[model samples]
Target chain A: MADRRYTKTHEWVTVDGKTVTVGITDYAQSQLGDVVFLELPSPGRTLGVRESFGVVESVKAASDLYSPVAGKVSAVNEKLSAKPELVNSDPYGDGWIMKLELTGELPPDLLDEAEYKKVTEAGAH
Target chain B: MVDFGGWELPQQYTSIRNEHLAVRKVAGLFDISHMGRLVVEGPGAEASLQWLMTNDLAPLAPGHAMYTLMCKEDGGAIDDLVVYRESKDRFLVVVNAANRAKDTAWMQEHLAGSATIEDHTKDMSLIAFQGPRAHELLPKGSSKTDDIPYFGFRAGKVAGESALISRTGYTGEDGFELFVDSGGVGEVWDAILAAGKAQGVLPAGLGARDATRLEAALRLYGNDMDETVNPYEAGLGWTVKLGKPDFIGRDALAKVKAEGARRSLVGMRTEPGSIPRHGAAVSHDGHHVGTVTSGTHSFFLGHPIALAMVEGPSFRVGERVTIEVRGREAPADVVKLPFYRGSARSAVAPAKP
Candidate 1:
């Protein structure tokens, strides 16, 4: 629970015991503009690391939401149905998309906070 | 970059939603330099336009502009344009960006008189300043909103440079579209930005322009209507004048007018807040009738809106329709066109000399 890692696709995953909470990064949310509709995975869905699990539709286009960790979906963000803007207002906080029960240990390819900054800086250009 | 009429342009500078809200709440400046401006000047200028355009141009006095469509011989639209009667022998036509080359060529080949046709798009830069506070933020000069009425334009000084200013826009808000020399266009843009900064003005991109125009139900050239789409079926029958003596596609249009079109443009709104995308299938009851031409989240309205060209069985307002949004048939209602209208151009007086 004390450490969180990010994916090259901008999804952030926080691992605590066998469960992990996943959501898009603040940088990703800002770039996405306003979040209007979220296609979330079902609670029973299972995903492999780096798999595209859902889509986030904004005012302009729909972007794929990728999973950073291999896990089975435990819960989805239900409030986004009425208030998807929460993703824009607070991406890492209230906008968290799903909770997943880990299928195995957290992936070793995940980037830490400082390493994630380097990836996003490259994307800024 | 998005391909808008062959021009690669940024779809959004910051964010589409932010840019949309910026124009609604404050002011937004758009680079519309890609739009074509053609000048027709000579003794037969009026006659040439009268024969080409569908709208009644004979009634247009000097310094007046009217929106019209130039249809093909088959009654399909060539382009939707605005014709300005600058003088008895002088006229200016503003055409969509994508159709500039085709429209210019079509008009030139059709001219059978002493009129001179000129394509001024390359030499000129078109900038649109739009929003609720546009009037207050526009640079002070002869092109002031108080002087130019809606759809009216005049050659005046803008930002210390000679420019043509028109009280016109597609955003349905109060605004001015200025045409400046291509070289000095950046200067005019910078000047307006500096003047309107305190008023919350933004250098908007195509993202905001699309949203704003869609809110007003203004049609996009390629998306809303194209060469394959007739003006009447596109819900732009108002621009076509059937009694205009003899114009391009007049006979075909007259016949089509008598026989109702099999398909028509209509607005669709979805429930559960699913935003439809372009090319999504549209259905009635359980049968597929049409496909969505343009669909997006109306940031200003806090809901989703779609423009669909559906088959006959003409949908009345409030009738339920389903759209296949993202592989699933989503429920939507066939609402009236123009899901939202702002207070911009709606507040201007009739354009006059």
Candidate 2:
């Protein structure tokens, strides 16, 4: 597994070769409460860095899911259609939202584990 | 946590889904101190309130409570509240937290005769214990709660602390809402949780409270009705008493009742994953007809449900409607109010002619 990188918006990405896996951090899922539904882009759709790719609907509210890096959508977690709660239970594993075929160099602004910790800490209050 | 009516409150103690199910299957405790509490007392208390509230309070004897609406002269609802008749000279009016200040002023401005109103919300603590097993699991140290009929309240002792226990709740379940001194409420709260811990009584929060109330089809103030929405249009016509000789909005409400309200509140259901949200547009045959007021995913019902304020004639049960979800229109069905029924002793507010 590669080192996980994060965005200030609370999404996390892990890059391996040319494929990058994306999911929201544990803190993000906790703040969102239960995950009820998610609308994701179909395969082959290209996404721009920082662009909103889809929506995540919880019981309390709906939030937009932002792309952390520019890439072509390769796959989405089809299981979420039937079992969205996985996002709350295992956000980093089976709850992985989508895999992106890296289109350009990973965004320079993506924070490493240590820097993302500071961002989450500042938001916790 | 979220800011609700100037109060910093948690949306859920844990997960909203767990807490919501706890209230339906076992029991859930909620700290609802944010709701406003007012005491109206004087020789003219009854007469004064009867004229201000839309519901006829003549039949509400001491120890009983009734749900009512306070309206403007134009028939728009100012607020919806529960009036508890403590006695012929004293009454307790509980109003929504967000409208506390406005309601307090309205009551004072409309004061008639010798009645005086005092705001008691800041000094009292309110807690709600609700579910099928709530009655059996409550920590009633010295209070005789068994005889307290639905909507009835009495001064009593719970967990050795003096409190006013009312048999009422927003959730569609048998429950009690306890009014205790702010200083002593912690003891009572702890005692109930300790006594019911083994029985699955969870401390719920605003999220669970909102979900359960929506499932019960209880109209939420501001969301379902406001100063611009009249009682008849909000499906709360039953709370209005046109027969009353004179009241603030009696004449206007009577007109709406006779001429028929232009819009009506109705329940709609959608498939899983297509949850409708507040302010979403509702249409039939591609024509805009309404907007969603309150909506959520009913975990117990395994589907999404909503309340919409629709224009023109009311839709019949099973009629088809489409709601805008995520920028696209999704098909929905006009279903019955209260998508599901729980163990509530009686309907919160019955629809009567």
Candidate 3:
């Protein structure tokens, strides 16, 4: 959890050596209630930092899923295609959207946990 | 929370999917106080309403309610509403929240008789208790609810508070809509939840309400029809009684009916993960034909459904169409209105125009 970094757009990222995993934060999922379907990028697709990779559709509206770090998609959570509600039930565990083979240094704007808490608090109002 | 028609209301209390399934399988309670309620009464109430509404009010006796539409002179719908005949000289007209001010002003400007209208929205609260098990789960000892037929209402007491209990709902389910004093509504809300908890009744919100109503093929005023869309085109021609002597839009509506509506509303279904949205383009054979008015992933039906208003000839059932979803055209099947039938008991079913 401490290694996890967040973006202002509410995506979270964590690095294990050069593999960076990404997913939407709990706050983001809470705001977009009852996710019904997600259009996820396929493995082997390249993405740039802060670039939209796919869409997340909820009952209320559709939202874009952005990449936190630049790299080629190594894997997509295929489970999400079948059980999109996982994004709401367990946002961090089974809901991790994709993993990237890191292509460059981590972005400088990623916020740490404590800093991300402030961002969520600011948005709560 | 979302700002809906100037009211801050929850889109869903917990989850839209859960609340929707609860209504289909058990029961769900909804706080619909934001809808506008008006009281019309006097010696000329019936005649005044008869001239204002498109539906024939003479057939709707006391204790019954009828769905009607108010249209502009050009036949475009101003709002769709329900008129409840409380008695010979009293009526309750429930209008959409967004169109409340406009509807009130229109009625006041066109009021031609001794009938008087009063805005009772702020003075009372409206709640919908709906589902298959609603009658069994309704709070015990409520008077006069046993024999209230579909679309019929009775003045009764719920949770020790005097309320108007109506056997009506937007969802295609057997349910009751309660009109209670605002001061006492909280108690009534709590009592129903506490009594029905064991039966898995959840306090639903706007999201579930919209989804269930869409499945029922009930039109949402602002989304499905507006001042530019006429009743005949919105699959609501049934609400327009051409036989009625004279109404505001009767001439225009009759003309449209005789000439036939240029566009028609049709239901379509798509595969899972391809949710159609409002304003999405609908096409046939690569030719643009229509736009989606309402759509959602139906958990109960295990697929996505959409209502589209299309041009040219109406598509036959089983015909294929394409709807733009997230910038791409997806194949969908033209289905019948009301993707699914629920437990509602009604005299007339919504028909395809």
Candidate 4:
């Protein structure tokens, strides 16, 4: 299994060599209600850590999608544009938003699965 | 849950799609207590309301209600409301929840004659049971639910609690809106849910309500029209009675009628799965013409529908327009106001087809 790290903003990133797969967490998808549309960044673009790279639109509202680490967009998820509900059904698998070529080492602030759970629980109320 | 005008309410109980389909195919119940309800009464209540609203309430007899608008002096809408002629001396006005204080103050500022307005929103609990099966699912209350005429209301006991049951709804479905005292709504709600379970009725939330209303082409106050939008521009010209005596925006609306509305709300449908959202730009032949006022994916229709405020009356039904969706211009065809018609419209008779 890939070791995944999470962000307070609900994005999850998994590193495999120099490439990383990024997607929103299940908790994030649930909170967004129904995912209707997504505007993802195109390949070849570079993003800084914590920078907004795209948008996720639910019927309730549109929220910004942020980058967890500095990286160059390697590939975009074309599947999401046609089936946005995949984010709700399978946020981790086929719902994976993008892949990136890491520009540097992993950020120090990324939370492991257990730490992310604690963060979500603390804010659940 | 989302904070809607300071009220924390769930966007959906289960899924937006499931809740929406439940309302269209079977039955659905909604807690609409967040809407503002006000009562205006006194010796000159009718006359005062006549001057306050765009609709000619002079012909509104007791037990009936009329959808109307309160406009500013500039002909822009203050709020769209339903005025209930409860009695010869009393009228009930229901406004949008977010516009409660603003609408109250506007009405009070125009206060005149022997009329007095009272806000009962905080003390009332309102529930809507809608769909083809709504009549069968909801408690009959104290009156025959079938006998109540469209836009008519009756005062009675429902689930052993005194309620005001009205034959009206926002879902474009034949249904009733039950108004009961806040303290006793629990019993009424329980009764309706228990009675509805057999019909596959679901306790719907705001998301389903939005889908149903939009499918009906019912204009939402803040989303489709606001203080800057006049009734005519919002496709609600029929509600304005120019023949009535001088009202708040009569002069301005009369002028607007002659000059014509600069923008008009039109309904449009895109191919299935392509949802247009509010603030999305609408273009005609490569020229930016309007913006999507309200848009949603209709789970029942299996496609996305939208109401856009396009420029002028030049845009005709069947006219093709393009809406910007997720940075791409997508095709949309202009259609008539309502995308779908349900039991409420056909309940009285059979279809010829």
lDDT of 2 by residue, B222-294 (tens): 8999999999999999999888758899989999999999999999999887899999999999899999999
DockQ of predicted model 4: 0.33
At residue A110, give the lDDT of candidate 1: 93
Model 2 stretches with alpha carbons more than 4 Å out: A43-48, A70-74, A121-125, B140-142, B346-353
Model 3 lDDT tens row, B6-120: 9889999999999999999899999999899999889888888888999999988999999999999999999999999999999999999999999999988777678899999
The runs of at least 3 residues in candidate 1 whose Cα sits more than 4 Å from the true structure, single-residue gaps closed, are A1-10, A25-33, A42-52, A72-95, A108-125, B141-143, B349-353
Better of 1 and 3 by TM-score: 3
List the candidates' TM-scores in order. Answer: 0.90, 0.94, 0.96, 0.86
lDDT of 3: 0.91
Which of the predicted structures, 1 or 4, would earn the higher DockQ when compared with the native?
A: 1
Candidate with maximal DockQ: 3
Instruction: Kindly list the per-residue Cα lDDT of model 4 for residues B301-338, writing each as its tens digit.
Output: 87789999988889988999999987789999999878
Fold similarity of candidate 4's chain A to the true chain A, as a TM-score: 0.97
Off by over 4 Å in 4: A1-4, A7-9, A13-23, A37-56, A62-86, A89-110, A118-125, B140-142, B349-353
Docking level of model 2: medium
Question: What does candidate 1's lDDT look like per residue over B187-251, in tens digits?
Answer: 89999988988877888888789888887888887887888888888999899899877999998
DockQ, 0 to 1 scale, candidate 1: 0.55
